[model samples]
Target chain A: MKSTTTWINSINNRFWRTIVNSTATGVESVAVFRIIMGIYLLFVTTPTYTWIADLPKALYTPPIISFVNLLASDFPGRNFLVTVDFLMVASIVGIVLGIYSRFATLAFVILKVSVLSFQYSFGKIDHDIMLPATLACMAFSGWGQTLALVPDKRSKWDSPSKSLSVIAVLIGFGYFSAGIEKAIHWLNFDLNSNGTARWFYLGLYNLQRQPILAPALKNAPFWFFKIMDVVGVIFELTPIIAVLISRKAWRIWLFFAAAFHLVNYLLFNINFIGNGLVYIAFINYKPVYRYVANLTKSYIAKALILAAVGYAAVIRGISILTSQNVGIIFIPDNGNANLYCMLIIWALICAALFITIFKTGKQPVHDDLEVVSPQLT
Target chain B: MHSLKFTGILFAIFLIPFVLRLFGLEPYPAILFPSGPETVKQVNGKTEIETKQLFAKKQNGQWALVEPKAFMYPVSAIQLAKLVSKNMGFKKQKPFPLKGKIGIVNYLYRSQNSSSSAAEEAELRNWIKKRLKRGNYQTSEVKVATYSNIISTTNGNILKKELKDEKYYNLD
Candidate 1:
C-alpha cells in the first residue's frame, strides 16, 4: 500500500510538472492555430479564387431536407451556404485577431452549427464536427489573452489558463463523444472495418471514395486494417485515459490526427477542421515562451542558414525538372507556376525574419504568469 | 541523443520527394480522367440506364436518359453525406423543378435520381454537359409525368392526355 501511494505521488508530480512547464508552448500553439484557421477560413470563402473552389455537388446537399420537409422549411441552398461561409470567415478572423472572442466564438458556433446541420442532413461526418463544441468551450475559456482581441488581465483569476483547462476538457469531450459513438455503434467498435478506423484508412490512404480499396479492404490477407480500426475506436472512445496517460502520448495522437488531416488535404483535397486547433487545446503555454526565448537566444542563426540552403535547392531543382517535361511545357499557362513563386518569396521573407532574430539575439523580456490550478489544492 | 547519420537519413527522406515534385515529378496523371460528356455511353441493359459522368453514375448507364437531368458539384464529405442522408427516400418519387439552358422542366425524382439536382440539380447537369463532355455516355428516353395535375407558366394549354411522347431526357 505504501509503495502504491508513493508511485501515485510520483506520477502526480510528473503530470503537474509537464503541465506547468509547457504553458508557453500552449500559447504559441493557440496563436498558430488561430492564424491558420483564420487564413484557411478566409481562403475557402473567396469563391473567385477557383483553386479552393474545386468542390463536388454532393457536399451541398442538406442532410435534414427530408426531415425539414416534414418538420421545417430550411433546405440547404447556395445562398444559405454562402452566408454560412461568410460568417465562418468573419469568426476565424475574429479568433485570429483575438477581437470580441466570445462573440466570434458564438458566431462561429452558430454558422458551424447550421453548416453541420446541413452536413448531418447527409449522414456523413468529419473532424470539423468537433469545432463547434471546441468553440463552445473556447467561449468559456479565454485563449484571447495571448493571441486574441482582449488585453491581458492583471490577475491569475482571469488568466487564459483557466479557460484553457476548460478547452482541454472540451477537447477531451470531443474525442470522448466520438469514442462513445463508436462504442454505441458496436459495428464501429472493431479496429478493422469500424467507422473511425475506416476513415483513418480511407482518409490517409486516399481511398475515401474510390472503389478499388473496397476489395482489398474486405478481403485482405492480414487484418492490418482491422487492428488499426480497433485501436482507433479504443483510442477515440477512451481518449481521456489515453490523453491523460502522458503528454508525449497525447502529442503522438495529435501528430497522427494532424497527419490524417494533411493527407486528406493533399490527396483528397479535403479540408478538415480541428487539424491545427487540437494542437492548441493540448498546449501548455509556459514552456512555449521558454522554448521561444531559448531559440531567440541560441538557434536562430542555424535555422536561417538551413532555410537559405533549402530555398536555393528547391528553386534550382524546380527549374531543372520542369524544363524537361513534355506535357508540362505545352500546357496553357495556368497561374499555379507563379503562385508557387510567390510562396517561395514568402518563405525567403520568413527566413530573413529568422536571421534578424538570431543575429540580434534575445533580450530580457518580462515573464508571463505561470498557471497554478486551484483544483490542485 | 540521436546519431547524425540517422538525422541525415531522415532529412533526406523528407527532402527528396519534395524536390522531385517541384522538378515536374508529376504526382497525378497528366491525362485527367475525362469528363462525363466526353465518355457518356449507353449500356445494353434492361430496367436501369447508366450515365457515365464524373462523380455520379446513372442507373441505365446512359447520360442522356435520366429525367429530369442530374449533375454533381464537388463537396466536402460531410456535406455529401448530409445531402445523401437528408434526401433519404431513394425509392420515393416527388415532382421537382429543373432548369437548363433551355428552360425549367418539372420531373418526378427518386433519390436514386442523383445528388446534384437535389442540391443545385440544374446547375450541375449544365456543368456536367459543359465541363465533363469527354466521358462515355448516351441519351435515352426519359419518363415524363403528366403536367395535367399541375399549373403551367406558359400558355394555359391544358393537355388533353398524359403526354408520354413529350420529349424528356433520361440518364440510366
Candidate 2:
C-alpha cells in the first residue's frame, strides 16, 4: 500500500513538471531565444529572398483548407513578397534589437508562413514548419518582456504562455512521429536481409551535393549506410524519449541532434539551421546570464572571443579584400570561404555555450517575483 | 491552465488513435503525432521507383525532358513559373478506392483516367526497354504498379499514391 502510494505520487510529480515546470522561462532567456530566431530567420530566408521571388504567387493551400479545393490561389503576388521582405527585414531588426519585438515577431510569422505554405502547396512540403509553429506559440507566450529595447513586465503575453511548453512538446512530437513511422516501416520490411537498405535507404545519399563529400558518400560501404539507417531511425525516436524523461536526457539528446544536423549539412545541402536554433526553446537559459557575469570578469573568455572573431571574420575578410581585382585570386571564387565562416560561427557558439556551462551549471536559478493566478501557479 | 488538465486534454487527443492502434485498428485518426505512410510504403515492398530532378525545358510552350547533364542548375524564375503551371495540370488517376457498399457511382466519379495510368505504365516500360536495347540487351517482363505513401505532419499524415515501375532485361 505504501509503495503504491509512492508510485502514484512520483507519477503525479513527473506529470506536473512536464507541463508546468518547463513553462517557467525568464524573459531574458526568452529574448535570447527571440534574437537567435531573428538571426536564423535572416539566414534561412536569404536564399528564398535572393532567388525564389515567385513563391508568393504560387498555388497556396493553408494547412486547414488543404483537404478541399476551395481556394488554391489565395496567396500574395511577387509585389506582396517584395513588400513582405522589406517588412521582414524591419521585423528582424526589431526582434534582434528588442525594439517592439512582439509586434516584429508577429509580422515575421505572418509574412513567412504566407510565403512558405504557398511554395509547398503544389505537392511539396519540407520539414521546416517548426519556424511558423514556434512563432505561433511565441505570439501567444509572454516571451517579449525581456532583453529588448522595450520590455513589458505586465503584458498579457508575460503570463505563462502555452506556447513555451508547446514548443518543447512539438520538438519531441516531431521525433516521435518520425520514429513511429520508421519503426512501422522497418516492421513491414525483410530486416534479416540487406535488400531493404539497398532500395529504400540508399536513395537518401543521392541527395548529397557537397563537392568532395558528395562523391565520397556514394562510395561509402553499404553496411555503413545500413548502420546509419538504423541510427537515423533511433536518433529520430530519441528526442521523444528524452523529452519524456528529465532535462539531462533532453540535453544529452541535443548532442545527437547537433551531430544529425552536422552530418546532413556536410553530406547533403539540406540545411535546417532554423530547427537547430529552435532547440533553445527546450533549454532553460537562466544559466546564460551567470555565464556572462563570470566571463566578463575573466580575461580568458574575452581573449577566446576576440581570437575566434579575428580568425573567423577578420582574417577571412582581409583575405577576400586583398585577393580582389587581381587576375589570380587566392581565395577560391567558388565560395569555399563560407565553409570556414561556418566553422568560425560554430566555434564561437561552442565557446559561448561551454563558458556558460562551466560557470553556472551548478548554480541555482535566482527567482524573480512570479505572479500568476492560482490555476497557473 | 492546470498543467495536469492541459496535458490530459492533449493526451486525450492522441489517446484514442493510440489505443485503437494498440487494439489493431491502424487507420484511427492521428491527432498530435502520426505514424505516416512514408515508412509504411517501404514495408512489404510498396515504394515506387521515381526519377527526381526531372526537369524539362520549355521551348514555345512544349515540355521535353532536359538531356542528362553533369549538374542541375537552379531553375530560373520563368522556368519555375512554367514548372508550377505544369505541375498543377499533371493530375494522375487515383486507384479504385477500398470499397464495398459505396457502389459504381462513387467508383465512376473517383476512378477516371485509369486508362491513362495504364498508358503511363506502358510508357515507363518502353522507356526502360529502349535504354536496355541501346545497351544491346534483350528484355523480358516489366513490372508496373502505383504505390501509396504520405507526407506526415503534427495533426495527421495524409495519404499519397504514386506509380512504381521497372523493366526486366537480358542479364547473362
Each model's total of backbone clashes? 74, 4
What are the per-residue Cα lDDT tens digits for candidate 1 across A222-257? 235445445555655453443455445555555555
lDDT of 2 by residue, A35-135 (tens): 56665554323333322332322222233223222234334454655566566666766665556776877888777766554554432345576667777
Can you tell me the DockQ of model 1? 0.04
TM-score of candidate 2 versus the correct structure, residues matched by position? 0.60
Best by TM-score: 2
- TM-scores of all predicted structures: 0.47, 0.60
TM-score of chain B of each: 0.21, 0.24
Please give the lDDT score at residue B155 for candidate 2.
16
TM-score of 1: 0.47
